[model samples]
Target: MFSKLFKSQSALRRFYSTATQNLTEKQEPKTYYKITLLRSAIALPKRYKDTLVTLGIHRRMQTVFHPHKPDIAGKILRVKELVQVENVPASAVRTKTEQRWERRPDPGFEVVGTWKNKRWLLDEEGI
Candidate 1:
């Protein structure tokens, strides 16, 4: 009975790993590391902050993308606890200007001759 259970567990593990592999194979290949800083490295060792600097992250919640290379992966692991990482395809990478445009707040509209504005003016005039 123990042999049967162990065999089943091994098979299940294999199935789980293969299923994830198949999904990745079907989807667009991940070529970039989307690294977003979630926590500050302040009060931590200088090495931690320096790793972030090397990765071009200066502020909390800042995101940067690097190619999926061994050295870049190592740097990411060094500060893994302070960041959120996602495997993104090359097309998902954006330029600095694009990121700024996406981050900027939407332009607001002017309230032109609305009923609320007219009511406010009349109220001030003792209407």
Candidate 2:
């Protein structure tokens, strides 16, 4: 029947739209750097320590994301012996807070309080 055919076509359209949306979300920005400190620069030359600091890596095993650029590439090359570098997609980068949130374990219990209810406590304490 024409109605059945029309329904299938509509479903196909919805499927195609969803697929395209997922593809777009997966698409990454032009270029990015995934820099991980493999070795510490302790006791090394001051230049090495300065380079690591410039790259935003504060310690060994720390990973930082940066945009791919000639200056950054030059800096990486300067301390290649102290780090492992790779190209990564933008979505792979995460902020410190996001990393903490990801590592946090969910509590089985829920917080059952509202600002309105707590307002009285604050008022009584003159806070």
Candidate 3:
């Protein structure tokens, strides 16, 4: 049972890894900007709010991906104190739905050894 489970897990991992590589290759460049809003612009100057708007960040914790360019870099610098910025590949970017899905917790338990795989408990002394 354990072997079957392991084999399935490995297959899933392989499939996802290759799929991820394809996705990245098709959508992302070697380098890009990952901008996440860490602080809100409320009660701040108009410039900060305008900058955030220009960067396409609407609220706190919102993340936006942009290409690495002089104009974008300058905008980031201008609002450096209000946001967290990182250089990431296009593959790292996630849409709103994807981000929400990723934030969800796992269901907890999973089936492992089954009746057909009694060999999984071979080393156990008291079964």
Model 1 over residues 14-127: C-alpha lDDT tens digits?
999999989877686889999999999999999999999999999998889999999999999999899999999887898778999998887796544567569657767888
Q: Model 2: clashing residue pairs?
A: none
Mind giving the per-residue lDDT tens digits that candidate 3 earns over 55-118? Answer: 9999999998888899999999999998998888877877778989999999898865677886
Clashing residue pair totals per candidate (backbone < 3 A): 0, 0, 1
Candidate 1 ranges with C-alpha deviation above 4 Å: 1-27, 105-127
Name the top TM-score candidate.
Answer: 2
Q: Candidate 1, clashing residue pairs?
A: none
Best by lDDT: 1
Report per-prediction Cα RMSD to one decimal: 13.8, 6.6, 12.3
Where is model 3 poorest over a 10-residue stretch in terms of lDDT?
118-127
lDDT of 1 at 46: 100
* Model 3 root mean square deviation, Cα atoms: 12.3
